[model samples]
Target: MGKKTTHKFKAEVSQLLDILVHSLYTNKEIFLRELISNASDALEKARFKTQASGETDELAPEIRVTVDADAKTLTVTDTGVGMTRDELMRNIGTIAHSGTAELAKLAEQGKESLDSLIGRFGVGFYSVYMVADEVTVTTKSMDADARPIVWTSDGRTDYKLQELDEDRPHGTEITVSLKEDLASQFTNEAHLKHVVKTHSNFINFPIYVGGERVNTIQALWREPKFQIKAEQYAEFYKFLTFDSEDPFDTLHTSVDAPVQFNALMFIPRHGNDPFGLGRENRGLDLYVRRVLIEKQNKDLLPEYLGFIKGVVDTEDLPLNISRETLQDNLLMRKISSTLVKQVLDHLAKMAKDDADRYNEFWRAHGELFKAGYMDFLNKDKFAGLVRFNSSSLDDDKGLTSLADYIARAKEDQKEIYYAYGPSREALALSPHLEVFRRKHVEVLYLFEPIDEFVMDALREYEGCALVSAEHADMAKLDKFESMEKEDKPEPLSDEQKTELDKLLARMKDVLGDAVTEVKASTRLSESPVCLANPDGNVTSSMDKIMRVMSKDTSIPKKILEINPDHALIRNMLAILEKDENDPFIDQAANQLYESALLLEGYLTDPHALVGRVQDLLTKSSSWYVASGK
Candidate 1:
């Protein structure tokens, strides 16, 4: 040492030191992360300068974390831009901000507020004091005129600054004399290596621990998309998620407007969880300038896009002084908005260019992504991306988008109709589909319970209201008649129509409050009866979900739509004509109501329906035997 002097720390810096050590930080291991980030930033600056000057700055930049257990010390050395005596005094010996009194109040307010540190200490270098009783820095500047100097501090009230005559390399070295309580955790080589891998693994420079490199994973998101190969992306994805298979689709996005961010996202072949459900709070790794700021940050993307897995690196996010939490929600929201648009744009492009691949993406992620109907700002885009099995399709394997359905829609049709059920086959059996089938209209088959919510959220798409088939207007649907003829019974005459009116009234009376109304329906062809919601404000799917959540097992009341043209209704009418108060008529009405309930999946008790079914079967068998063939 050539010369030595002592200096007192700024008033606010002393208070902030107390907060950093005792109050704010719950995880003490991150202090090493803060130190490493500062080192990385320094190295980046040196690298930029070398590029600007078109020459080597001194040495190839690298970060080395060395742990000394016996000596109770940990040292982090970085070959980057170093500081001079004056720079050290200004940066470390005193306050990094002006107005000490004002910042002192801010620091005092944060005594228990783990929120922010008003007194920032040179890009978070002060974090070292969390595990140390004293810290020593030895450095020589890249400027040849500057001499090697040393700054030692206890981080309490003051620090010691001295000049060195020995010729040290141009870089910065920080060694911490660990505090007694934190020595075992901070000075263990394995523990320090783990911390580096968790937080600073993507640092631009190489990091070595005990002669072995620790940060080997590349920050691939920052690279140009075209420059990388598919194999490289697969390797990175596997390393990120530990999944052996490659991704179904990869979205490599670099956005410059609203908020600048580079994101490389993946849609896994099977979701991150085995269930294939994507509506989760699972988030992506959030990095600021290539350094991990928050892992699995849930707010970066909406929960509907939870199936998307990858890293997001932004260069201009405002972070709290601790860098542990986001500071500005508005900036974050802007970034989120940009991410959503880019993702939707990419998906729409995928849909247009490669439909088979897009449908494969849907099979894997549609259940999760459908919940995005709540994203109204991009509802049109989301609607365009949705895929559903339809009535016109032969099986569930065949899927269609709303755009395709609309392209083939009838000229007079004004709504996009859908029917909800557990499977494609179940929806196909819905009585609401008869008219659509007759007129050759397409009806989307919605399977998941969440599909109801999606339809409700997205009330319309491209000028067409999304209407459930159960709530279809009979008067409007009757207009579009199919030209094909059926080989069925003749139309009813005036006298039979009068007889059917009495039968309808009788059936409604027997069912009591079980049905709101029992009326004739042209919407049914083969099916004898179907249930419809009378309220019109709620669809059957929505009502069923609400009833189930409330733990109400009772069957919901609904309007019964009877196909008078069907043989069952004609026979019932004839029986009513013979005897106005017949036992068979009452039994048949009750059975019809319960059967409708069963079709709607709301029937809680089926004993009565089963007994009626057996009675009718036995009577028909007796008639067949009595008739002698």
Candidate 2:
């Protein structure tokens, strides 16, 4: 062996390589991807040269990976534009030099084209050190007379280079002697083949592992949508998801202006159970020039759209800095914002073009989609896509979007009203909806756990504020213009009104701080009583939210509104007039308050309410016995 010259790696390179081998890459297997991607770039350069010069070489563009388990060595070879000794020293010896800059220089001489080159960050070749204890490279230039050269690195501080006497093929070959711990993983033929198929399966050049072709799946997103067929999309979706069912929606998007990218995304036939898989499991695969950089990369899309599965290939993305993470860069932000807009716009289109399909999607993924409702940048857009069961809807399965609700709203209505409950039946029976029903005003039924959060974040839709049905402000809403103007109930006689006021004071005294206020309510048309948060106090939804967050559980005081015209209240007045201290009246008053609390979903101790009801039942039984019935 000739005397090899030992040269130190660049200062920036040594530090960068240390980070890559120890910190930058989440998985050491990424070394294989980086090396293979570099090999693919060399092959692409070779193809471009041949095309530009109209000269052919005997070597076809191919990447071959061979693993020797016993020797604990992995080798990757590519038949592409090889480098001369000087070129090897300059390209691989130094770090952070743009490989594309060299190609650009060659283009100036009419010898190479920079358009097809895939690598810009020169440090990708150094990732081999992440898995390997040592790496060896052998290359000969595409020029027939060029001498072959060898470069070796231990990946720490220095690399060695030497010229070879023997003639070499026109390409580059890299051999990695993996560390003792990584031998079984990197040296096994099956494991190496799997890595190749996972990372470089869609590289334009064929990749062979263990003498078997591994990159069989084409990067279909790279193909124009016009040239692709429906069957092809179905086949690709099946291949991507492994689900037999067709995708609910497919968005094949390609953009070039802000940041170039091609995305083939699929809204699954069914939403992914993110909780089951861990939220981190949901994301799109990120690729650069058809080579997988990150698998299920969450940063590509917001968590709300995590149910979406697909591949996003962007040549403009600076994924070379770290195989483990794409830095939070402007380009990535641009891509993410663009992707979110595309998804929202696609959903909007689906809603407009086909109601049933959109409704089907909403039924399957509405909870997942609710995440976007809180995104202030697109709040209005997301508001138009929010779905709910409304009073006008026939059933729970029948959903109405905010836009539709607003469209069908009364001309004078200034707010969108919603009532929250555990189920549609429960919400339908809520006393808070009585006045709305009497006036024939629609009320959206919110049942999803996240529905409250969505409404809270989206305080308004269109030009109207979102108001809860239980809100005291509902009384101020414009009354139905066509509501029959029934004669107002005769004003209670002055003495009767005084008696009623005295009765309210007695009840308030009995309840103490439990009742914020006991007053007559016109909002109630059928129900005897209902609860409302004192104006400017925390709402019921806010109370529920605080409890869910493990915050204070103290019951918020509420105003107990009684329907003065109701028969129950009239009888209570007569009982109070005869005996203001009647024990039966006290029991009835407390029970009424508990019933209101139960309806409001604030009664935490149902056993106490049950006991109260039992006492009332016993009292009734004694009265019946006393009357000899």
Candidate 1: lDDT of 408?
A: 85
What TM-score would you give candidate 2 relative to the actual structure?
A: 0.88
Instruction: Point to the candidate with the largest lDDT.
Output: 1
Candidate 2 residue lDDT tens string, 59-151: 878999998888889999999898988888788767544444453453344312211222345456766776778999998888767878889
The backbone clash count of each candidate, in order, is 0, 0
Candidate 1 error regions (>4 Å): 51-55, 98-112, 118-123, 273-281
Considering only N, C-alpha and C atoms within 3 Å, which residue pairs clash in candidate 2?
Answer: none
Name the best candidate (by TM-score).
Answer: 1
lDDT of each: 0.82, 0.80
What TM-score goes with each of the models?
0.94, 0.88
Candidate no. 1 TM-score: 0.94
Cα RMSD to the true fold for all candidates: 2.4, 6.3
Number of clashes in model 1? 0
What residue pairs clash in candidate 1, if any at all?
A: none
